[model samples]
Each structure stands twice: as structure tokens, then as C-alpha cells.
Target: MTDFLRRKLIQAAGSAAALGPFAIGSVSAQQKGDIVIAASQPITGIFAFAGTAMNNGLNDFVLWKNANGGVAGRKLRYVSEDSGFKLDQGVAIFKKLMASEKPSFFYGDSTQWAKAVAQDAVAAGTIMTSSTSLASSMADPTGMPQHFVPGPIYGSMHEILMEYIAKTWSKSDKPKIAYVYADTEFGRDGIPAGKARAEKLGLPIVTEIVTKQAGIDVAPEVAKLRRARPDIVIFQGYILAPMPEFVRQMREAGLQSQVMGTAWGLDKPAYDALGAMGESLAGVSPYRYGHETDSTMINAMRDFGAKNRPDMKNISPFYISSWLSGMVFAEVADRCIKANKPLTLPNMKAALESMKEWDSGGIFGTLVDLSKHQAPVGRIYRYEPKTKTMEPASSWLKV
Candidate 1:
């Protein structure tokens, strides 16, 4: 770790120690061979399908880790609550877990909840990860220092996509682009940075369309996009519903612009909803798909699913991402123990930041980097209807 990061960890540890009983009490009384990990997940509402799969994947990883002797011989005790995809509910669940469970680590549901409980996590000296990969704000070491993810943030994904677009542009004229995102923090988190990057690439953002997560009428949005006539439309902040509706509506309105999505916007659930329309879609993703059998981790996930959830047919990208999140926490915790450091909040943070080119067992295409607290690498993939898969359009690019 650099001097700057070391100082930040020391300060965080000092703050926690100074907070007296509350901070001290935040550490759960683990029995021999026990480490508690808690999460607030979106098991209902708009993100229900994706959230439930994420929960299952996380739970399965914990089970698999325990079966495999866990991290440094300490069995993980994973606990999670349903957030219902509501910010207030997520915060409430987080507080409940912090107060009652006193877990050493927490996995939050969204960018909003991560931001909401950041101070609490820091004050209590708890390490926290999130379900969302690319919330750029959470990657600020000085701001939400305890926040970390297993994949790149939204901004990095957008930057990679923009670079790809710049290279792929065949015309001498600058490519016209438009951003169509949900009107939520998750949807709009990366737009400003993305817009700045686009400007730098000489791609004019012709239109910006913000609609509700559950947009009932997308004709107007499609009409605006049609008028702009962008060469490409990048989507953010949506998992399945409005995005598919918008794409279908765009097609209906005779808009032939190539559609792309952020990580959240490009997943099995989204493709299932998009059907044939998904063929024209492409996006940046931090984790390999569940169908990528070549991955050892993915193969393990498949075996676990076959034995545990035989009724379930497919493991989505969201599930893989969630599983990777759990694995990352376990990896960091194990490293702390191997270094003879107690699995305290400060120690966990240090272990995470100390990681440099650490292999993720193929959870990600590139080695993990926790200094930025973001994955910072991914591949752009285009959906292939014939194979019914998102085939890689480019190699893993670190941003």
C-alpha cells in the first residue's frame, strides 16, 4: 500500500477506536471458525428477478467456501435481508444488520444505499461491498473509503465503450451519440463522466433522455431519439423492464441506431425481456457469463447450481457478479488472516488495497486491483441471437 492509503487506513482505525463502545461493539463476537458477512439485497420490486439471482449466487458462494474450508479456516456466516429495491428499506435493513448482526462485512443493494450508509460503515469501521459494480462515487478512497467492488465502475465501462466506438467509427464525420438512462442514481451515476469522455473523443451527444425505471409510455422517448438520429444509444440504470420496452418502442418507431447498455442494463434478464431485439444489443461487463464453461469459477458455480438448484435452468450474469463479490470478500479476508492480521475492518480494508494483479480465479478476465476499490477492467460484448449469448467484441480492456 502507498503512504497515502496507509495513512487513510490508520485514520479510519483511529476514528473507530475513538468512537468508544459503539465502534468496538460493531465487531461481532465470532465463535471459533466463524466470520459473519451480511447483505441487504433487492429481492422484490423492479429488480426482483436480478436481485433474487444475486442473493442465491452470494449464498451459494458462502456455502461453497464453507464446504471448501472457507477463508483461512474460518467459516463464513452469510446473512442477508430483502431490500425490495427501495432505498429506505435498504438503509433500514443495513442498520438492522449493523446493530444486531454486527457483521465484519456488508454487501449493499444499490449505489443509493451504499452512499446512504457510507458514514455508518466508516464510523463503525465495517468493510462494505455493493451489488452494483460501477458506482464511480463509491470508489473515492477519501470519500467512501470502505466501499469496494469486484468489477469496474460505470464510468470506466462507459469510457471503454466510447473508446471502442471511436475506433470502430468508419466515417470521417464525428459519431453522433445519445444517452438514454433511467431517472435514478444508478442510471445517471456515470453520465457526467461519460459525457466528458465522449466530448474528449469528439463524439457529440445529440440527446439525453431520462425516463422512469418503470416507464409505461416510451414512444415519446423513442420519438426524441429518432429526431436526434444518433449513431449509437447507450443505456444505463435499468436491468430489464423499461430498457426492453424502450428498445422495442425504438424499433417500432423505425430507429435503427445501435443500442448499447451499461453492465446492469445488459444481463440475462434484460435479454430475456428483449427477445429478438437483444440481437442488436451490446455492452461492457465486468464478469464472464455463467455460460462461459471455460472458466473454472463458472464451472464450479454450475456444479453448485446443478446440485443445489436443479430446478433452475440457467445462471445469469447477475448471479456470476454476485458470486464474484462474495469470493472477493473471502479472498481479502483470507489474505488478512494469512498476514496474521485480525479480520477487523481496518485489516480487511488494508488487505483489499494491498491486492495488486491478484488473480480472481477467472471471476474477471484481468487481475483484481483494489487500490481504486473498483474492478477497472471489462470487455465489450455483442449479443448473438444464433448462439443466444453475448459474444466478446473486444478483449479485456483496463481503464
Candidate 2:
């Protein structure tokens, strides 16, 4: 890390440590004492990288908002639980948060957990959104009402990747595609979507590679993809697993296949691992690191990093995503507070459902069109290791 980046990370860590356990003033003292948002993440196990990023973003946003006088003049409180990437533990933690505090909102770590929380959130009438981009099923038009996905669903990203390849590699015959995916539901979810789109584009999936979360070796898989000579290798795995290894090995083996990643597996850890070797590894992401478009929000993020998390240089898409979540929650709560609605789960859901083309200010450009309960669209970013940066590969895609 550069000297500037190192100093920034230290600041981020200090800011994170200063954020204590969440609490609020007496409900009787104020109609809206504190806005409690419950976050359940896998901070200990396989998805530690993403979980850490999500939590750090959540805490950082809360601190940033608090420093600015908080959301709608109400302080934000959060109960973040570590689920250890276990499904059973996830359910237990969700129950604890619901039973103890009855939080106004739920923020989930991964797609599976997002689905697990959907029914209860709806039954309780609490508005919820996820950092997970894979739960298109939960965000399905016909399925859940109180749930929102702020990023591109994996299925949509896969479609975009295929189109990019088709338009970019128009002349290649037998454009072989390789698949390297984790065995978990979140990782495997991208495969069918990718395959269906690949078939439509007439591209052949020549090599299929699956690895256990416990075992993340991609050398064998990379060798297979190399042998197949695929024009592109699509990676779908945990952030902590085979992705970085795959990228490094693919480069070591002299494989020229372009690397495309599904949503969950895309982040800074992937880039930091492969370094310059990760240049050709492109993935669909919700936010671009070097975005020149929203300077105001970008600057706010920079200030936050400089003040609190200097170590977390090159902010991940999850940072913007979590920041947006906090911003949206605050805005909706503010609307309810202004309308004299009670500050409770039901009231919050009412406010969120009534939310139209809500702008997240400079935090997010996508309109929070509640008709879809999803971000208007998401952007794709490609990592350019040569510059140690990530740049937009396309405009916001609405698929």
C-alpha cells in the first residue's frame, strides 16, 4: 500500500473502533428516539472479506451521519451480529435481533441470508434491503414486498457480461467460456443465468469448475480452462475463496482468457490479490472506485476514509452500497417524521413503499424506484491493475 493509503486505513480503523454498541434515548423522551438497523454478517468465516466491508461501511456511514446531526434529527443505532457464514446461526441471530430490539430495518450479508429474513421482515412489516446482489428471487416482482436489492442481481450481471463479450468478440468462432464457481447457493446461482445467456449468444461453455468453500484451489481449474482455451473465464466464487487464487494462477499459466466475475465475488480483495495480474479480470459491480461522476459523494467517502478508515483505500462497491442503505433508511424515516407518522416498523414500511423516485443525494445516482423495490440500475466496473484503479465498463444497466 502507498503511504497515503496506509495512513487512511489507520484512520478508518480508529473510527471503526470508536463506534460502540448501539443504543438510543428513551422512546418517551422523543417520538423517534433512535433509528435501529440490524445487520447480520459473516464476520468470522468464509465471507469475512465482504462481511467486514459491509460492516465497516455500515459503521462508517452511521458515524458520518451522526457527525452531520444524524438522520432526520434522530440518531441511528445498529445491532450487527456475526453469523459465521452458517445458515442456522444466521436464523438464530435474526431471531435475536427481532425479539430483543425489533429493529426497524434489516441488512443482510449474502443472498441466502437475505432470503431467510424476507418472510419474517414482511410478516413483521419491517422494510429491509440487502448488500446481496444474488437474491433476485427475493426481489422478484411477484415475491417479497418489503425487500429491496440496491445492486445488480447476479443474473443481470451475467447477462451484461455475455453481451459485452458478444459485442467485443464478434468475429471469434467457438468462443469458449469457462466457469469457476463456489458450491454454495450464492455462488452457484450465477451459473444457470450465465449458461442461458451464453446459449442465446451462441457461446459454448467449454470448461466447468466447482470448488468447495473449504477448498479453494483454482490451479487445477485454471489448467482446465487453459486447455480448453476459452475466450473468457467467468468466475463465481466466495470473496475469500478461489477467486484471487484463480486470477493469480490464470496469469501464471499464461491464459489469455478474459476474466469476468459475478457480483458477490467482486471487490477490493480480489483486486489486491491479483494486483497487476488482475487487470484483465473484469466484473459487474454496483459502484466504480475511480468514479469521476459523483464528486460530491465521492469526496464525502474520501473524507470518511481519511477521518476513520485510511487502511481501506480504494473504497469497495459495498461501501457505496451500505452508505446508500443508511442514507435511504434515514431519508424514509425523515419523511415519516415530517408526516407525523409513528416511528415504528409498520410506519417505516409505509414510508418506504410510498417512496417514489427517491434520490440518495450524491450517495447513489440510481433512483430508488419503489415500483421495483430495487435500485434503478447498477454499473459495471473493470479493474485496471496498471493504474491500481477500477473504472466504469458501462453505463448503468437496467436489466
Candidate 3:
């Protein structure tokens, strides 16, 4: 990593009161408090693009909240360490925080880490967690009571994309569609359900291509897409690579398919990297972006970024997800405290379940209903490369 990036990460691990946890990586936090919100963040590795932003976003929110008199007058402490996006390291960090920090709420790195640690978390019943992964399985409040997905499940994101496509079909024939995804769990987990939704909408899925998440060779994939000539090509589980190359090659092959993606593959940076290729790129997002004034949370985020992180022009969607996680944590904690309950597993779990039609300060344009443990909502956005902004393409979808 560049020296500047390294420094920023160390700062993200900044401590709150006393020296932070040392066994994990450098730990940065916000405020000094008893209600600990610890995290096993993916600060380095293939996912750093999103993970680092997550660290900053959560830490920043904690700082912001502490400035606003904290929950129930109890201070909130935010502690976190970089797990380098590794499952083993993330699990270790989780264990360390649960043991040493004795936190009331936690943020984990991925769907894998959340599933791996759920049994332990539920057994402890003293803490609750939110993760970057939006796996549908984690949304089951009955099965994974201790873990909650921060946004829409992987399948619901796909289903929302299908809804957008179905509504926008101006062609004489039903739009022929192609689904391209990586071979990872995040990639393939949602395809079956998404395909089912598309079938229900009577949209013809012409092809499904599975490939590596990031690699140099996409010619073979593009060759298949070329042959299919579907009107829509939707991507999932990819961060940056392959999508740009695939789009470039498809255009070179003289095809005119509309390219779209789920949340992961369509971050602002991905589009910024794509430059002109992203001009035609439209994707679904669970949270509102920073370019608009419609959302109270989005506006606050924009002002906060300008003042605190001036170098970062566009706040990341992953960061918004992290901030949303912090919101949920604080909300649960506040509810528990107000109810004169301890921050135990059952109490906090009950507090979380009680959330219905909660206003997220406009983070979500619509009132959030997390009764199912995942927010199955999204809005379609088209990239405006000239302005480096994500402009809305469709209304908010609560699927």
C-alpha cells in the first residue's frame, strides 16, 4: 500500500480512551465509553477498497454519535482491527474482541465470518453483530439471531434488478437477459433465487456465466456474451475487475446489451475506474449516495466527508453500509437502555426485532423495516462519469 493509505489505516485504528487492543492489528476507535461497539474489519487484502472505507465509516459514525450525547447518556466506544479480509484472521479478531473488549455489538467482515461465529455469538447471548455480507441466510432472525445483514440479501438485490428490468421493458419482446457472476459464495448464492424471480416476471434468461472474481482473461467470457446477444447483462459478486474488461470487449464486438450490477460490483470507485464504460452502467443500491440532498443521512455524510475527509470526494457505498450498521447498533443499544434492560443477547435481540418502519434519518429514502434482519430494498442508479456521480434511474424498491 502507498504510505498515505497506510497512515490513513493506522488512523482508522485510532484508540478511544486507554490503549486499544494490540493483538489484532493497529486499533483505532472513537470516544471513551462502556457500551463497546467492536469490529473485525477487513482493512487490508483484495477487499480493502471497500473494507478500509467501512472502517472509516463506522469509526466516523461512532465519533459523530458520541458528539451528539451518546445513547441514553452512556458513552459508545468503537474499537476495530484489520483482518486483511481473511476468514481465519477475522474470526480471531472477533474472538479477541469478545473476550477482551466484552463488546455489546460487533461488526464482522464477510458472510463466511458471520456464519462461522454465529453459534458462539448466540451462545454468549451478550452481544449482537452486523456484517458487510448481505447473505440471505443471515437474515433469518430465527436461525441466526445474533447476526443481522446490513442491507438487502444477495438474492433480493438480484430480484430488485429484475423488477427494474421488467418495468423498463419497452421492446416488443420480453428482454432476453444474461447473468454473469464470480464463482465465490457471494457470487453464486443469489443466482437460483434471482433466476426464479426473473422467471416469475416472465423475463427470459438467455445465459449464465461463472468465472473468477478478478482476472486478466475475459475474452472467453465476452465471446460467450457476444454469441448470446442478450439485451441485458447483469453482474454480481465482483468488485472491479472483469466487469470493465468484459464491457469493453462486448462493445468492441458491436453488441448493445444494457450492463447492470448488484451492490458489490457497482461501487463509485468501480465506475470511476471504468470512466466511459460506466456511462452506460446502471446498478442497484440499498442506500442513497452522497450526490443528492434528499436524504438527511446522505446530506450529513456529505458535509462530514467534506469537513473531515476532504481528500475523499465521493463517499463509498460500503462506507454507507458500515454507517448504517452503526446506526442499527446504536438504535438497539438505545432501545435496550430505555427499556431498563441489560445489553444481553436476548434483550438486544428483542430490541432489534422491535425495529419496524424506523426512520434511518433518510439513509434509506423509505422507512426501514428490519423485522426480517435484512433491508430488502434498493434503487437503480446510472453512472454519470462526466460528473463522477451516481444519478437515480428508478424509484426506491422495497422488494
Candidate 4:
């Protein structure tokens, strides 16, 4: 991680710790006067960049809420641990937090971790959970009532991208599609649905390539893609590193296929990494970028950063995603309070599921509905190397 990001993370940790528990020894049973919010984040691993941004956003939101007298007159006590983006570590952190903090709300690091602890979370009966993951499996209301997402599931996002590809394809041309993903739960989560959606749209999926999340050499995968001669290739389960390398290698190999990515692959960092090669890149995003000053939520967050974190210059999409997730939690807590309901897991679940047309202050372009526990809305964006930013390629599509 960069020195700037490291310092920002340290500052965020200190600020959150000041308002709540920082260690297991400092935490006791949940107090009636405090609302504990615990999380497991990938603060020091393959996803450190994203995890640090997410942690910063979550801490900023918690601190902002506390400064504003908190929700329902109850101060939110934020606590978190690093999971290193490892499922075992994530599960262990969840168990430790539950036992030590007895938190009412939990933020998970990955979909695998959320799935691992879903039954336990339900059995616990009082704790509600959200995650960085937008896996379709986590949206099950009957089985995972206490778990929710801030945006559309990976499958839904994949479908939206597929629909875009289909709509844009010429009637006389049959576009060949390729799927490249990492060998992780996140990398593979959307494949089945993406394949089905492609079949339904009559887009022929020519190949599927599996690569490491942080692969250094993608020549082999690029070779496969070159041979397949896909019209478009979609990447999944990567944040910054490997995808750019893949794109660079593909370009060097004279591959003409247009590259698209899912949420994880759609960010400024990726564009910055791709450099001039990113001009042809396009992807889908659940929320607007931090540089998108037109958004009320982005403007508000920028103002917050100027006042509180003057040293930080750029806010990435990962940060906005985490901040929006915090907003969702706060909104649900406020709703439960207004309804005169106890702030328990079940009440929180009800409040989340009941959300409809909830304005996110332009965090999401349209009103949010959580009837399915996922925001079924997103937009396509193409990266512009000349401007070094992602420009909207399509209006928000509701899937």
C-alpha cells in the first residue's frame, strides 16, 4: 500500500477506535446505550487497496453519524478486524467479534465468509450482517434474512452487462463472448448466471479462462483468448493488478477483442494501471465514482474529506461502496427506531426488506428497493485514457 493510504488507514482506525472498541479486551457485552457495529475487512492482503478504502469510508460514516448525535439517539460503536481476504481468517474474525463485542450489526469482508456464517448469524437471533460482497446467494431472504447488500448481486450485474452487449450487437453479427475470472468464490460467483444470460440473449460464449487473483503473467490466458477470437471478453473477481496485465498482454498479442469488467474491475485504479490501453475498456458499476461531482452523495463525501481528511486527494469507488453500505445500515436503524421497534436482527431485516424508493442522496442514481436484499440497478461505463476517468456509456439499467 502507498504511504498515503497507510497513513489514512491508521488515522481511520484511530478515529473509529476513539468512538468504540478497538480490541477484544476493551469490549464487553453489548450495552443498551450503545449500538456496536463490527466488521471484518481485507486490510492487509490482495485486496488491501479496496479494503483500506472501504474501512476508511465505513469509519468516516460512523464518525459522521456520531458527530450528528448518532441514530435513534444511540451512538454507533464501530469495531473491525483484518481478514486478509482469506475465508478462514474472515470466519475466525466473525466468530471472535461475535463472542467479544456481541455486536448488533456486522460487515463482512467477502461472500464466502458471509455464506460460512449465515446460519450462525441467523441462530444468533440479534445480529444483522452486510458485506463487501454482492453475491446472488447472499440475497436469499428466507435463508439469509439478516444479510443484505448495498447494490445488485454479481449475477444481476453480469446480466445487465450481457443485456447491454446483446442490445448493442448488430442483428447480422453473432458476437463471440469470453469469460475470464479468478479462481475464487468471488471470481466464479457470476459465471453460471452469466452463461445462462448469454444463452438467453443468443450470444455465444466461446471460452472461459481461470487466472489467479493476483497473477503476474497472463500470456497463457491471453493466448487462449487470442485463439477464441471473442468479440468481447468480460473479467470477474479482480480489482486492479491482474486485469490490467491481462489487457496489456492481450493488446501486445494483437487481440482486437473489447474488454469489459464487473464491479471489482471497474475503478480508477484499474484505468490508471491500464494507462493508454484502458481506452477501449468498459464495465458496469453499482454507484458513481468519487470523481463524479454531479452526485449529491459524492459531493457530500468530497466535502467531508476536505474538512476531515484534507491529505487524501482521491476517493475510489470501493470507498463510495462502503460509505453507501454504512448509509444503508444507518437508514435501516433509523427506520426501525421510527417504527418503535427494538433494534434487533429481525427488526433490522424487516426494515431493510421494506425499503422502497429510498433516495440515497444520489449515491445511487435512482431510488433503492431492497425487497430482494440487492439493489437491482447499475450503469455501463467506458474508460477514457485521455481524461483518465470512467464516462457513463449508458443510463442506469434496472435488472
TM-score of each: 0.89, 0.78, 0.89, 0.87
Off by over 4 Å in 3: 1-33
In the range 29-126, model 2's lDDT, one tens digit per residue, is 22546778888877889667667877877778888888899877888887798988888898788889878876767787766776676666555433
The candidate, 2 or 4, that scores higher on TM-score is 4
Model 4 lDDT, full chain set: 0.81
lDDT of each: 0.78, 0.67, 0.80, 0.81
Worst 10 residues of 2 by lDDT: 20-29
User: Tens-digit lDDT track for model 3 on 1-399?
Assistant: 235434432332232112322222222222224689999888889778788989999998888888889898977889999999899999999999888888888998888898888766766656789988887787987667777888888888889988888889964688899999889888887888889999999999999999986655888888998899999898887887778878888889988898888887778657876766544678888888867898888788888888899998777888899999999999998996686555656667678889988889887788878888888888999887667777899888978
CA RMSD of all predictions: 4.0, 10.7, 9.0, 9.0
Worst 10 residues of 4 by lDDT: 22-31
Error of 3 at 97 (Å): 1.4
Let me know the TM-score candidate 2 reaches against the reference structure: 0.78
**Pairs in steric clash, model 3:** 13-27, 13-28, 14-28, 14-29, 125-345
- Model 3 CA lDDT for position 247: 83
Model 3: worst 10 consecutive residues (lDDT sum): 22-31
